[model samples]
Target: MNGIEAPNRLAELRQAAALTQQEVAERVGVPVSAGQVSRWERGEQAPSLRYRHRLAAVFGVGVADLGIPSAPLPRQRSSAEDWFVSDEQDPRVTKSQDEWRRTRALLNQNRHSLSQVAADLYPEHRLAGTGLIAGGGWIPEQPVDLARIELSEVPDAPEPVLSGGEREAARMLPDQTLTRSYDRYTRAVRDLAPPRLFEDRVSWRLLDVDWSAGAGRMSFGDTTYFNAVDVFEPCAHELAYVALDADGGLAAHPHMRDLPYRKLIGSPFDFARRPVMPAISTLTIRRGAGDDVSFLLHRRDPRAVAAAGGMLQVIPSGIFQPSSLMPAGRAADFDLWRNIQREFSEELLGMPECDGHGRPVDYTSGPFAVLDQARADGRLTVHCLGVALDALTLVGEILTVLVVDAPVFDSLAADFVERNDEGTVVAERFPFTEGGVRGLLDSGSVAPAGAGCLELAWRWRDVLL
Candidate 1:
C-alpha cells in the first residue's frame, strides 16, 4: 500500500468497526488516551502489539487487514531494533552486512506472499477459488474479506454467518463519524514543482446551460477547453455549479456528473481509485461581475484562464488581466457598453421613437434623476460610489442595484454580479487557503452601471435583403 492510501483505508476499516476512537482504543487495549487510536488511524503513528491484537480480535480480521505490518512488542530488542523503526521516515537504520542479507531474504519472501495475496484477492489477478482474503497477517483464525460482501447482501448472506465481530463492524460503520480535515493551511509555499508542470490551461462551458457547442472536453493533456457564447442578461447573485468530464469516445451523459468530492461522491470506486474520471465545482461569484471579463466571451469562445502565484487572473486579447491602474472612475475608459438594438433598427428602418431605455415617457421628462439619502441623529453621513447610470436605461433587463447617493445623477448603476455567458458563476475565492481569490484583479471596489461588473448580452447583426 502507498503510505498515503493508509489513512483512507484505516478510516474505512474504523468506520466498519462501528467504534469511535474512544471505543476502538478500549477494545484494542491501547493506552487510556483516545487520541492514540485516532493518530494511528490518521497515519501519524502506529500502535503496539497489544493494540494490534486487540484490534484484530474486535474487528474479526487479521492485523494485516489494516494494510500494515503488525505492531508486535519488541523481542530481543537489540536485534529487532535494526530491522525496522515504527515511525522513522528513513527505512535505512544501522544494519550489519549479515542482518542486511537476512532482511533482503525476508523481504523477498514477503513480496511473494503479497503477490499471492494480490492474485487471490484481486479479480484482475485471475487467481483460482473465490479469490478473497489473501492478505498475509498473523491471525489466530481465518481472516475476513470485507469488500467481498456488499452492504445490500448483509441481510440475506446465510444465518449464523456474521461471527459477532462482522455484525459489530456493520453496526459501527453506520454510526461512525471519525474524521480528518485534509486542509494544508500553510500560507507560504515554495516551488519544488515547475510552473508549467502544474495544471495546464483548460476551458469549460456551462453543461446544463448549453451542451451543444459544449465546452471542449478533456483531451490528451490536462485541459478543459471551452466555447463561450453570449447569453441573456444575467442575475445579480444567483448561483450555479460548474462540472467537467474527461471526454471519452462514449457519447452518453453520465448520471454521476459531479465527479469530484461532494455529498454524492458516488460509489466506493469513485474515491477508491482515480477519484472518478472527472470533477464538479461551484462558485459563489455571480454572472456579470467584471473580473471574468472576456471581450471574446461577448463575441467568440473565450481562451482558457490560467493561474500564477496561486491567484487566477483573467486574460483578455491574449493578455493576462491588465493592471492598467485603477480607473479614474474604477472602470475601463473604453465604452465597451453598447446599444445593439439601435444599430439593428438603423439597418432595418429609418428611425425609431423609443429612447435608449426603450421607453416613450421620454428624455423629455426634463433632467430625470434619482438620489439616495441616509440619515442619523440630525446628521448626514456622506456616502458615495461617485458614478451613476441614466435612469431610462433599464427596460428589459434585471438591475443589480447600488445607486450612487448623488443629488443629481440620471442613471442607475448596480452592484455588479458576474458570470460567463453559460451562467457558471466566477468566484473570487474558494475554501482553499493557499491558492484562492488573490491574484484576481481588485474586485474590492464598488461600481455604477445597471450591471456594475461586466455587461454581457447576446448581440447579432444581420443584413436585410
Candidate 2:
C-alpha cells in the first residue's frame, strides 16, 4: 500500500481491535498523545520507522500487514536513525511530557475551585461548611446501623447507555486518560503496582438509601471496581480537562454540559444510568479525657492513588467492599464496622491491602480481634455520620467517625506506621478542636467527605463525648 492508504488502514486496525486512540498511544511503547495517533490515522502526519514498528506490535500484526514498508522512507531520514532514538530523544515525547507536567500543575492548583463549583451546581445535596452533599436526610451527627445496609445480588446489571452526544464524544476523545494517569502514578511510586487484581474485584453499588426510620436504610447491588474506573473516574478527568479553560476559568465541555447529579436527583435510587459506589471515610478520634481529643489525617500520595490524591483525608478511608470474592465472605463483610476494621489495618497499620483474592478475613484474630475486643469493651465507638456524593465525580461516601478511648488508641498508635500503601500520616495528629477543624477546612486541601465528617463530629462532640 502507498503512504496515504497505509495510514488509513491503521485506523481500521485500531477499530478492529476495539481500542481507543489513547489506548493505542499508550501501548505503542512510547509517550505519545492521542492527538498524535489521530494525526497518524487521518494521514495528517506520518509515523517514523520506530513508531510504525511499535504500532505493528501493538496491533499484533506484521509491518506488511499494517501496509508499511519494512525499509525507512527517504524523507524520514534524520541525523540519527529512528530505531536508535530513545523516548527522551524524541521531541514529540518531550513535548507530550511537558504538557502533562503543566496539566498536573493546573489540576493541583484548581482542584478546590472545581469542587466548589460542583457543590454549587448541586445545591440540594450540598451540606453546609463542607464540600459534600448528604441525601436521604442523612446528615452529619446522625448515626446509621451497619446491619440495616442491605445487599441485593445483581449478577447481570446492564451497562449504562450513553447519550448520542456522549457516545460520539467517547468515540472521538481519548478514553484512557485515567488509566494513563494511573500508569504515570505507578511508575513514579516504585512500590505501587497497577491494581490489576483490585480492578476486577467485586464491589457494592449504592442503589438506594432511606433514613425516615431514624437510621440509614441502604440498598446495594453487586458491581465491580472496573465499572467505576471505566465510567465515573474518566468522567471526572474529562470534566477537569474540558471545563478548565486556558486561563483556568470554568466552562462545561460541550458533550458533558448537563450535570450528572442533576440527571439522577429525580430518581437517585435508579442504577440504570449511574452506578454510585460509596467509599467509607472515618474520622478516627483519640479521646483521652473531657476535652482532650485528637484526630488523625492522611495526605494521600498523588503518585500512589487514583482518587483524592494530594488531599488531606480522614485516616482509614476506603471503598466499601468485601475482603474476598467468595459468597460467604461477601455476606460476612457487608457490615460497616468490618469494612472499617480492614481500612484501619491497611491504611493505619501498613498491612497489605485486602485485594479480594485472599481467604475470608478472620475477625477473631490479629488486629481485627484487637479492634473487635475494644468495641465490645466499650473502649471504641464507631458511628456512621451520614452519606454524601462527591459533586464532581458523582461518587458516594459513607461518612463516619470512630472514637477510641485513650488506652485503646495508645495501643493502636504504638503500631501505626508513618506511611502506608496509599499515603503518609500527617506528621502529628491534629487536635479535634474547632480551631483545628476550621484550619483544615480553610486550607482547602481536605477531601469533601473528610471535611463533612470533621464538621459533623465537632458539631456533635457533646453527644459523642
Candidate 3:
C-alpha cells in the first residue's frame, strides 16, 4: 500500500480458502518452501514479480487485490510513433505513471523507511520482507520512526543479527607481504617511528577477549609479536590492547597482543578469528558545487611498510588510544577529534617525513593548525553519524562535513597530495559521485576500515545530503 511494512491480504485470502502455505506454494509453483510464504504474510519479504501472477491466479483475484497496484500489459503498437500516441491516449497508464512519481517522492522523503534502513545497516543480511519482484521492484513494507533509531549500540529488543558478509570480508583478504617494514621508513618516515618510549605507551596487561559471536562486544590485546608478513585478524576472541604515545596521547601502533597459540591458528589474511577493538572511522566530507558533496581518501604507496599499502582507503582511521580513556594531565580533555586530526596529518598531510638526515622532523602541529583555520573560517562541521557494528568490527564513526569555498578546495587538494607523497600516502582525491563511491567500495586496494567508512558515508548520504 505504501512502504514495505504495509500489510498484504495474502494471508487473509489463504486462511479464507482454508489453504496451507505449502498448498499455496504448490499451486503458485514458487520454488521456495512454506516458511517463505509465511514470511510474505508476516510482512518480512515481498513476493517477487515472477511469483505475483501465480499468487493472483491461485487466490482468484487481481494483483491489486494482494495490496499491490496491477500494471497493465504493454500495448502492442504498429509503429514506434504509435507507442507515444498510445501512452498519451491511455488514462490508466498516465495515472499509473503519475502515481509512481508521487510514490517515489514519498519513498525518498521517508528517510527512516524500515526496509531502506535495513538495506543500509545490514547489506550483509537478508530480511524476510524485502526482495525484487519484476514489476514491483524491491518491496520493503516496514515504516520506522527515524527519531527512535539507535546510534551507539544495536537494539536489544529486535536483536542485532550477523550476516555472512562480515566473516567473508575478513576472511577474504588477498595474500600479500603482511609485515610492516620499519627499516624502509628509516629515511622518509624516520620522525614518525612509533615511540614505545614511555611506560604508559605500551600495555603490558593481557586482555581477555570474549562476547556473543554477533554482538559488538570483542577482546583485544597488545601487539607484542606484530611482524611485517603477518595479517590482522578479527578472531572471535584474542588478547589485544590499545597502543599509546609518550605524552599519554594515542599512538595507534597497529599491533595486537596475541598469545602464541592464538597466533598459530590465525592467518593474517583471515579475519574470522580476530578480536574486535573500539575504534573510529572518520568521514570528513566537504560541500562542493550545488547538490554535490566531496570527501578525501588516499592510497598507500606499495613500497610503504604500513599495514595497508597500495590501497585507497579512509586516510585517518584508528583505534581509541589510551590517552582518550585516561588523560595524563587534568588539563587534557578527552576528545576523539584530536585523534582523528592526528591521523589525518599522519596519513594525508604527510607531516612525519624526515629531513636531509634520517632524523625525525616535527610535523605534529600542522593538522591542528589546519583544522583551527578551517573552523575559524566557517569551513568545518562535525557529526557523529552513529555506530556501525558488524560481525568483523564495532566502530563509532565521526562524520565531519566541511564546506569550503572553491579557492580553498583547490589549495587544500594540491597541498594534501604533495605533502603525503613522501610518506605512506601515494594519492588523494575527493570522490563526489555515486559511481566514484562504488569504485572505492569495489576496489581491492581499499583498506577494510576505509571500505567500511566509505560504505557508511554512502548509505547515510541522506543525512549528509
Candidate 4:
C-alpha cells in the first residue's frame, strides 16, 4: 500500500536547525531510515500522533504549528437566524406552518421578557425595553389654535392578517426607538441625519402636552428608546435597504464587533415604542356647486416599502422637519402649515423646486402662494384639525383640513399630471364619501399614517360633504 500523505514542517525545521534526517530521527527516537525521512518530507508518509508530538518538540513548535492540514472544524453560527434555536431530528429541516404560528404566539407571550433580555445583554446600547420615562418639563411659548379632534370614538382595529414569515419578522423588531430632545422641554426630529439642512426651528415645551389622552396631542412622553444613529453602523439608509431586500422589514443593519460583542443584533429603531415624531397629513376637499364635497386621494407606488407596498392615502402627506419649516426665524408657529404646503408641492403638484430627500432645491411656486390666492378668492380655506398618534408605529400626525372648490382641484390635478415624470405617485382621484375612507381601511392596504389621516378626515364629514 502507498504511504499515507500529510504536510509537516520536517523539511523546513531540519534545514533551520542545520540537522540531517538521521539526526532528527535520533532526537525523536523514531527508528526510520533517511529514505523514509525524504518520503515524509515529500508528504508520501506521516508520523503517528505520538511521533508528531516528539517531532514538534524537537522542532521547538506545537503539532498544529507544523503546518499540517487537519480536519475542518464545525461551522459556527454567526447570523440573526442563528439565534432562532431549533430542536429536530434533522437540524436542517425547515419549520412547518403550525410551528411558525406557535413560534409567533410564544414570542408575543414572552415579548417583555425578551426585551428585558435584550436590554440586559446590550447595556452599552442603553435599551430601556418597554418601560421608559421621557418628555417631562417644558412649556409651550405660544398657544396653538389647532382644533383637537377626539379619537376616543374611533373604532378598535380589526385583527391583522399576516403570513407566517411576516409574523416571525415582526417578532424580531425591538421594543425601543430613537428620539432627539432639544433640552428637557422639547423633543425634535429631522427627516435627514446630521440635522443641519435647515435654519428655522419651532419648539414646544414637554410639560405643555397631555399624554393621558391617546392619539391626538401636541406632545408625547415615552422613552423606552435608543438612538438609531448609535445602534446602526455605516448608516441607517444602508440598513433600510438591506431590511427591504431581505424581509421587507425596517431593521438596523448589524455589524461585526470585537469579542463578547460578537453577535450582529438587528436595530430597535423602527419597532421601538419611543416618543411621538411629527408628520403632516393634508385632506384636500373640493366643494362643487351646492353641498357636493369630493376629497382627493392618492395611491402609493408599489415599490414603496414604507407603506408595505402600494396603499391608498391622502393626496399629500409627509413628516415635519425643523429644517424645512421655521426657516429664517419667520413664521415659527406656522411650521405645520409650511410642512403641509411643501408636501402638496412635492407629492401632488410634482414640482421639482422642492424635495423630500435633503437635496437643496428652491421653491419656485411655493404652497403659500396657492394658499394666499385661494384665501384671497374665498375658494380655499385650510384648517388645522389637531394631532393624532399611531398605536403601532408611535408616530404622531398633524391633520390639516383643506377646503377647495372644483375649479381649484381641477387646476391642481392637471398641473400635477403635466409636471410629473417620475412615477413616485401611481394615480390620483376624488373620493367623496366616508365610505371611501372606510373601504381603504377595510382593505388593510392603507398605512398606519394613512389610516390616521382618514380617521381625522371622517370627523369633518359634516362640513366636507
**Clashes per prediction?**
16, 0, 36, 3
Task: Kindly report which residue stretches of model 2 are placed more than 4 angstroms away from their true locations once superposed.
Answer: 1-105, 145-172, 175-198, 247-270
Candidate 3, 1-465: lDDT as tens digits: 356554678888888767799977666542556876887677656664435544654564555678743442343322322322222223443333233222222222221221223233234442221210011111112211112222232112221122212432223222112231112211111111111111113211112221222222122333211211122222211111122222323234232232332234333212233322334556556676785567766655422222333445555654434332232420131244555655666555555522112332222355576675765676654444333322222222222233345455565556664435412443445566788877755544454445555654566566555
Q: Give the Cα error of residue 40 in candidate 2, in Å.
A: 26
RMSD of 2: 11.5
Query: Which residue pairs in candidate 2 have backbone atoms (N, alpha carbon, C) closer than 3 angstroms, thus clashing?
Result: none
- How far in Å is the alpha carbon of 157 misplaced in model 1? 48
Point to the candidate with the largest lDDT: 2
The TM-score-based order of candidates, best leading, equals: 2, 4, 3, 1
Candidate with more favorable, higher TM-score: 1 or 2:
2
Extract clashing residue pairs from model 4: 176-272, 200-326, 215-389
lDDT by residue for model 4 (233-286), tens = 112122232323232332432332321111322232222222234556777777
Better of 1 and 3 by lDDT: 3
lDDT tens digits by residue: candidate 2, 237-286: 44566568765677653332454423433333245666677899999999
Best by TM-score: 2
Off by over 4 Å in 3: 1-276, 302-306, 322-333, 353-367, 389-408, 417-430
- RMSD for each of the candidates: 27.3, 11.5, 25.9, 21.8
Indicate the TM-score of model 1: 0.16
lDDT for residue 437 in candidate 3, whole number 0-100: 77
Best-first order by lDDT:
2, 4, 3, 1
